[model samples]
Target: MATDNKTSAILHRDTRFVPKKVVGGKGSYLFLEDGTKFLDSTGGAAVSCLGHGNEQVNQMIKDQMDQVSYCHSAFFGTQVAEDLAQLLVDSTGGKLSKLFVVSSGSEAVEAALKLARQYFLELPTPQSQRTKFIARLPSYHGTTLGALGLGGHVQRREPFEPLLSRNTSHVSPCYAYRGKRDGESDADYVVRLAAELEAEFQRLGPETVCAFVAEPVVGAALGCVPAVPGYFRAMKDVCEKHGALFILDEIMSGMGRCGTLHAWEQEDVIPDIQTIGKGLGGGYAPVSGILIGDSIVQTMDKGTGVFRHGQTYQGHPVSCAAALAVQKTIQEQSLLDNVREMGAYLESQLKQRFENHPHVGDIRGKGLFWGLEFVKDKATKEPFDSEVRLSSLIQGKGLEPEYSVSLYGCSGTVDGIKGDHLVLAPPFVVSKTEIDLLVDTLEKVLKDVFASL
Candidate 1:
């Protein structure tokens, strides 16, 4: 067991905190070497949908290792990889017909961007001028340069701004809590957002744009904010009018995180290119991929007949086997049903607890994913000062021995540098008892933190 006093070789996110070493985990709880158990509410940034120490997934990984763990996709494709890809394709009802597997969410977004650009280039008309992409403000795509440029999270991109690409632009996100006007109806708000997108396309010259990228439900950067009704269809219409592909970044909200198997399913509009990760492998392995629509697939088939981008571990046998097992388990256990039922319960409990809290500006989300936004004045929806670090305090207090609950906290929700919010995404296997405990512990943590302030 690693002692707390020992100097760590791994460079953690914050050197000051140096998080506790987790020794083991099962279901919705993680255990420390000292026997302290933490109820995992955020699932390590919403990745472990099936929870920890899943015997079935573990056995599958081991079994795959015994046969063959590593194989080059170019040299040979494993049956597991093909099976997983086919399953993902079928899950989309043939909407997204092809899969380009990768090792992380960033890689998936990178692949999507490259594929979009290549699609335009490969077309018979050859739109060589279409080199620009339009994303949304307060959205997070990933950390890599191309993906980072495609995102509009101001804080995360500030330090690397010089190195980021200039081909991408951003528009206001469909955040009803703030973006919606005082008396505006949902349809009006959507129309306004669509107008902004259309204006952006015109500003950039429609023929020069390759794609419009967005998240079906904004994650950390905006605290689980879902678009208003008809928001997606409106944006898709604008993209269609401008002849640009519509790409949905489901890296954090897809794969049953938001009730449905795909977040876009709830929106009633399909994306031309979709990227999925995090929950794909349920934290059993690092896996992500780009799902290509029929048009893009056909374009590539008729042109170069190959995607230019490739990763060394693009289709590792073990990762694919683990992902296949994870997906199969979700389907076999009918976890989506549980997610919906439990998610409704969780949402009700959260509203009942924080509805009147002075610091809680909003509580919003769908399925098992939820976010609690903090503010100084609920009436004005004024966020707390950045220095207050309210979300971090709540996160730290929740992890203390007294609470022993884990929550995901993020900053810059308001404008990429000022807002604070906490996310709760328990595993699909989470029970009602666990949900109650999670809320109770969080209530105590909130009371304790606020009392000190």
Candidate 2:
């Protein structure tokens, strides 16, 4: 696969192969170097919310570059950063008091973890023993060491186990499709999950726990699985009971990607600290941020008057300008309204197409973010062996000439090594026609892959 000079030039995610080169992109399609255009159904891991070749965002980057691009956070601050931060804070109705901008989701999460610990330390009654975190199994936060420690994806953390922080522990996620017992009511399931969290806190000596971190809508590791109704509120109650912060990792599910600007908004719960990324900069620039709530901010303000952490490029001017433009465009264009409308259309189309498929065990998600979990037997919900790489096959088939669609596929949805699922997160600008094409292409790809299997 790397026989060609271009393919061998750089080390890709898998050294065994290099993907086709995409020369350009426009709207919802990416043009390969060979002239084939593939529909970007997954938005490149749900990052490109505004789609490609956005003229306004590109112009914004250039304009910012002409003025100032890089400014060290410790030495100076930029208006672009302040404006973006203010907009983010305002969007949350001041519930989130401050924004700590960073380059990626992992960095944002790392900052959040550190901030949580610092918040406890800054309290009038210091919680010096509060050093541990409780995260959900089959969840993904980020790749950085600190963020990875807070995640619960077994396979991902396996290789780095020796190096991971022992301060973190895992709990079962609120995965109704798998976790809920037969004939169990949603309320009962919520109670069960909440009890499990409370048990974990007690087991860890509740006073030693700093936070309970999770993605409101589980991403890559669990394939866009949303919490059961009232699940987050219950989980937050447990956290509050233990005096631990509730941190929501909204990297792949926020910034209007999940109908609402923040995924937690739909859950009747607000996190004390939130990390947002992916769609924040709309793939126009590398940008992510932590939304610090009033309690944390006020504690810092009254205690040290400064956060102990700082990054050299904490708020790169160009990145801030690009994100500002992307966010403003989302608001001025009222893209959330489109997201809701198109999301409903997409959901209905997917159910109509795959609800009865033998291999499709479950179809779940919210807004434009949706996932299809495949299984060997739909009734039994038995997943194909991980060695089969069913999700990867489906993803590869989408990029073929006949299908021409890009899908996000991941393994280990069940227990971090046994389940297969594909995620589809089209851009907010997706039209009904495009949504139909996406579903049709996905259906064809699934059929083709299953036929071969």
Candidate 3:
């Protein structure tokens, strides 16, 4: 995978190691400059939903560029952006009235936070005291300061702690693998989590909280863990009781990636603010946004009629157009049904391959988003030493000629420093043969790595 780093001007995530070079991609695979091909199993942090070189998405972007590439959203309105927002609202049956588009998932969270605070301020009674936010620990909202502050991944947030806002606090997430103690039923765990959330609000003075933020299906921080039954409902109940808006960050797990248009659709609760990205634009452009429920949208309409926040690229025409085309493609092609069928097939194949494997701790996810948490001892669920870098090893090996695969890998799944996980979020347009190739390659990769270990 070595390309070159000495002369590079880009400051990549790792300067110590140079990565492979790619010349082009089409469908479910990427072609290296030298023509070495690799299946894109994780889609570069799960962003490329429609897959590489999607003609419809590309055509839409090009057409949008031909029309108007960069119209400052502040002074003008773009029909493409408006149409995108309308599509999103209609997808939710208009339960959510508005969406504020941003350039990335981080920006969406930032906007949601600001809007939530403003929602309280615009209320008739004006609860300006509602300034705090509660998010789950071992969770990731985004990488920007406010989003990072709100995200509870300890190691990622530690270096920037002094610069982050102090108003956001954390509570335990609904990670059944580690969070559920012996003999704790799913119903019991939900109650316990709800109580903990209530306690956090009480300790912080419930009146001071503006929103409760969390992911419906936990991403990297917990390795594709979905909350237990009734979990979201319980958390939302706590938030409602505290007069705090409920916010769901579905950046990595929404937009038909989870076999549904919205991950919250399966949860049976509507979020007051829902942040979506990654799959939103299908890697056609830098994009993300927050869909606001009527409770907050109408409140602002009756009051300021303006959300006191704006980004230079907010509601960028090209990005919105890309997203709209991506969504339309998904709908027109019936990709959600494929996600369900393929998801079940992928799930079955995964369990059949790794369920009995000693090193695979858990296989968790829904639809196309799945993850394998590596453990040293499955019985005790003890994680490998962080120094082993097992997840990255699996990822690196997966990309080698022998395997020819790409996956999203991360460590510190347990307490931000003690666990390892490999994510498998293939493009929504993947086919059965591609799924077979992915699983077969993964099995060989896992077996090969475990042998050396």
Which candidate leads in lDDT?
1
Q: What's model 1's TM-score?
A: 0.98
Q: Once all C-alphas are superposed, what RMSD does model 3 give against the true structure?
A: 1.0
lDDT of 1: 0.92
- Tens-digit lDDT string for candidate 3 (366-397): 99999899999999999999899998899889
Q: On a 0 to 1 TM-score scale, where does candidate 2 land against the true structure?
A: 0.98
Q: Write the per-residue lDDT of candidate 1 for residues 116-184, one digit (tens) a residue.
A: 999998999899999999999988999999999999998999999999999999999999999999999
Q: Model 2 segments beyond 4 Å from truth?
A: 1-7
- Candidate 1 stretches with Cα past 4 Å from truth are 1-6
**TM-score of each predicted structure versus truth:** 0.98, 0.98, 0.98
- Residue 105 displacement in candidate 2 (angstroms): 0.6
Model 2, range 1-453, lDDT digits (tens) per residue?
123546466777877667778899999989988788889989999999989999989999999999998978888999999999999999999999899999999999999999999998899888899999999897889998988888889889999989989999999998889999999999999999888998999898999999999988888998889988899999999998878999999999999998999998999788999999899999999999999899889898899877989888799898899899999999999999999999999999999999999999999999999999999988888999999999888887787777889889999988899999999999999999999999888888888899999
Query: Ten residues in a row with the worst lDDT in model 2?
Result: 1-10
lDDT (0 to 1) per candidate: 0.92, 0.91, 0.91
Summed over model 2, clashes come to 0
